[model samples]
Target chain A: MSIDTDDPTVAAAPDPEPDNSLGGIFRAYLAKLRGGEVGSLPAVLGLIALVVVFSSLRPEQFTNSFNFANLIGQSAGVTVLAMGLVFVLLLGEIDLSAGFAGGTCAGVLGVFLTRQEWPLIPALLAALLTGALIGLLIGLLVARLGIPSFVVTLAAFLGLQGVLLTMIGEGGTIPIRNDFINGLNNANLPVWLGWALGLLCIVGYAASTYITDARRRAKNLTVQPLLLWALKTGLLTVVVVAVVGYLSVERSRNPALTSLKGVPVSLVVIVGLLILLTFTLTRTAWGRHVYAVGGNAEAARRAGINVFRVRLSCFILCSTMAAVAGIMIASRTNSVNPNTGGETTLLYAVGAAVIGGTSLFGGKGRVIDAVIGGTVVAVIDNGMGLLDQPQGTVWMVTGLVLLVAASVDALSRRRASATGHV
Target chain B: MSPLLELHGVEKSFGAVQVLRGVDLSVQAGRVTALVGDNGAGKSTLVKGMAGIHLFDAGDYLFEGEPVKVTNPKDAAALGIEVVYQDLALCDNLDVVHNMFLGREMKRLRLVDEDTMEQRARETLDGLSVRTLKSVRTPVASLSGGQRQTVAIARAVLWNSKLVILDEPTAALGVAQTEQVLRLVRRLADRGLGVLLISHNLNDVFEVADDIAVLYLGGMVGQIDAASTTRERVVQAITTGVVPEGGAA
Candidate 1:
């Protein structure tokens, strides 16, 4: 496997393979490809280990299909919000205002649709645009005014909180009146339709891989072994299908009580976003530029890249995503209130991002990591609730898991650095 | 014919510290020029001025014998002058193609054209005979020093640069990697591009360069033919700031 040449740190590690045996050599090659090529395998596995530990603690509830669906629905907002956070974080900036952005946007959208009796389309656009503008203003302050993003965004966080409180008014609650928009929280495609969609997505992914590899191989180029490539794609397919089935089962079971269970429309939007972002970052040039700027701004600038444009773009993306998550939360509650977003939601979003394997230092991360990390958080939350643990215990447990994930990322980065993997 | 790039009586400073003092350098087409100097001898300052990162205090920069005042690095790039900094400015998380086209990616409808980018990246690397690399998709963090240097040079050439400035490409490379890089430098000059290579390693300078320029304490000491120069004399010029034949500063 060809190693990444940009990071001298990870590239400096001594070659660990010299054996010629077929089995041993192949395993070592896999490790090199999987471990060093795309971030870290340790962090990914650590996330799983955390999930396993939580499941073992409350096997009857955590491992159950109903609870697994609950986890997905519960984590959907945080996951989407964290995805946007990853963009800003990878640029080595903090958007502490993410929670507040979501809260204010959600409240604003509710007011537009319910109080003003506006249509859903205009209300949604206004909410998202407001969030984007907030981020744009913050970007301008940091990029042009020479203020640090941390300070600029922090001030925004506090200011947005006050705005949200005022918007909620002294009563502190406003119910959404629009039918089509409010039903987004309760809506779901049929279970079989979900399965079909899952299959279609998996098939599309496999086809894209086959076509790209075939074209490359026809030119006598270096293509990854079919077996290795298939192994990863197959795993992705299985995980996706299983998640759909679990959500479907939960939806079917809830019909016995309130007939109110299914894959929420917000969840679908979140998945669609994941696919869009993954394609943008991995398969596009702007994604490459973003990674370049994050990796080394000076180097990127010298290469004739517009460093300012890429950074500003990241902030815009991040705030727009937070707005979407805020809309989802508001839809789920069917109400906007002062307490819509708080310290708990903000901490969870940040934790989910770190757990997803985005580097605290920037220039390394995946959108998929956010999804997995969000799931891990939901697993812990849903399982602890089943065990009847106090809210404090839930917070402590999540904090510990977040700490471990962060430690894994830090150690791997040092390893990558020491080995000249830069 | 006149030199491809000419720096006539250039003077530059940073803050209150004077760095380049009326330095004049001429790089002819189809030849390798080596820059040698002591640690604080203003080599970086002179190069930075030419690269447009630092505007000269007083100088006339001529391209094709016409005086041109460059405002920034962007102008230099548009004029086909590419400078590969000592640090190389590569992002490890990105693949070779991504690294090569970091800021200027080919996109259609706001999406990167991966297939075409990969095709071109492969062609550039292959043309250079960079055999050490296994795949264009491999992250740069995994390449050996020699391979990483190859990627940087390829990127400069791919952008259709006329003059290439490499800052100490072999300083931290191993023996094999150094040999690989020196070979690439020789090939670049053979392609008729003007190459200004900065190196402390006399061995590398002697092996690849056709002409050598020496600097001492923010001033040009002398420019001599590489074939007629010796490592000992070069070291002496660097340390004692005396060329012995009269042109010291």
Candidate 2:
């Protein structure tokens, strides 16, 4: 009988078995890309292309171990901010105040540390708490009072800038001298410890992949071919080994005076957050509810989900992450000022997310997308600096890139709908 | 046998307009009772009352011969009452399995239990004899209209629901899809559940409904066996707000 038959009896028969071979999986992935589910393919390709072009043009500066580490440090703050924005974007909501919110949180931290003389941990908590309160107010205005998120966050954006300025006394800046706080961006893991962490990441990934597939097999659900899994694991192994190996080489300007080798702690922080957020989005029920609400709020409500709570939590998560990003920025600058988390910070974070393939329309994104896209942004900024390009040129290029990414998002969304995959 | 659900003197009004005026209706287990009416005949208002979207102004809402209060949607759900709205309400971005268990996800160790949910969704679709769908994992956005209706029906029955109220299941479907949905409705009743189908199509009512309940203006005119009455008589009752001469009331 034809599989297309509408006969209930024939239809009730077991579905045609899916092809689980590596070739079959590859073909399916290609089909998905054509259907406008590109995920992070474009961002990854763009990152590689930029790296190649920069290395060819200014190989001495762009490809050095010191610059590589610097790129990671530079991207960490924006990557963390983008990671939080992904949560808001997944709900089809925009948090325009996220940059200034970060600034305000950093100002809070600066005050608690320098003025109150509180220890590091308590000051960090106060900063995070400030972020949460700002988020809660915005969430209430948008989710509960039914104000458009764009307007609410835009208002917060202007208001939070004032809050930050007042906290930092307009023209004043607070210098951070604490060793541990400063070390977040300046310190590096020992070479042995960096190697151990890299291996641990690979092993954890492999174990999770194997265990999930095994469980699916036990339940008689379709699982990807073993070869495909091995290919992915092997690819990750190569990348990890290459990165750790490159960073292990000493890049100290004067070897007799100092030793600078090993992965930056900022990189570690980003990776840890990536793993945690990715797990929350993929493995937990709350994450599933977030996707559902983003996809269709009315349907989610009809299904008995608390639409308001889901929205509120997302705003909270976004701001909390922004606070963490604020900390990273302050650490990198060695001080907190009114401008710490302002001036293209929010723009780059948003660009990073969209360029990485997260739909601004909601219900489609991943935490890893932010990291890949953040790398792209950092590369563009770093490469231009190496070439001695004007600041105006840099802003125009970044704006043009963001415009292109958003256009791609809109066009892909149309294609997805036309192809019945939306 | 006592009816699965029985409403006595149910009256509902909105502001200055009366929508349901002391209406009485009953639905039997192992049978399909089609509620037929014109646009302003209080059909939706009555169904809303039953689903607890709107509380009746005054009424004795009885289920299984016992008076029960259905003040909200949750209350109706507690009584195993499920409504498949005309819009379907399935999230386009989610696959059929996810849509089926949207808010009520099965969880293990604080994580969504995908394995158990997939298995149960597969079994539920199979039990309903649904064949048009190739895979339950397919996103709802990609499914045909008939396939979406099938998923919605399956979701309604998945909860051990005793009463399934369908609001215009075939309203937006083509001929073949309408046939598929009518057959599914027949199967639900055949499985010994009370199926309350609300529709404007006479052909659909004649095809699958075992009993016909006609509403006119704001009152239920008559509830009669489909086999004993003609379509013309039902139409007369719907328009005139009165059972026809020599028609069983």
In order, the Cα lDDT scores of the candidates are 0.79, 0.90
DockQ each candidate and list the results.
0.42, 0.52
| TM-scores for candidates 1 onward, in order | 0.89, 0.96
Best by TM-score: 2
Q: Could you give candidate 2's per-residue lDDT for residues B1-249 as a string of tens digits? A: 999999999999899999888899999999999999999999999999999999999989999999999989999999999999999999887889899999999999989998899899988888888867776777776667888899999999999999999999999998888999999999999999999999999999999999999988888898988998899999888888788887765
Best by the lDDT measure: 2
TM-score of 1: 0.89
Docking class of 1: acceptable
| Candidate 1 lDDT tens digits, B150-191 | 888889888878899999998878887888889898988988
Query: Runs in model 1 with CA error above 4 Å?
Result: A1-30, A33-60, A250-262, B13-22, B57-59, B65-67, B108-110, B216-221, B232-249
Error of 2 at A34 (Å): 2.0
> In candidate 1, residue A258 scores what lDDT?
51
Interface RMSD of structure candidate 1 (Å) = 6.6
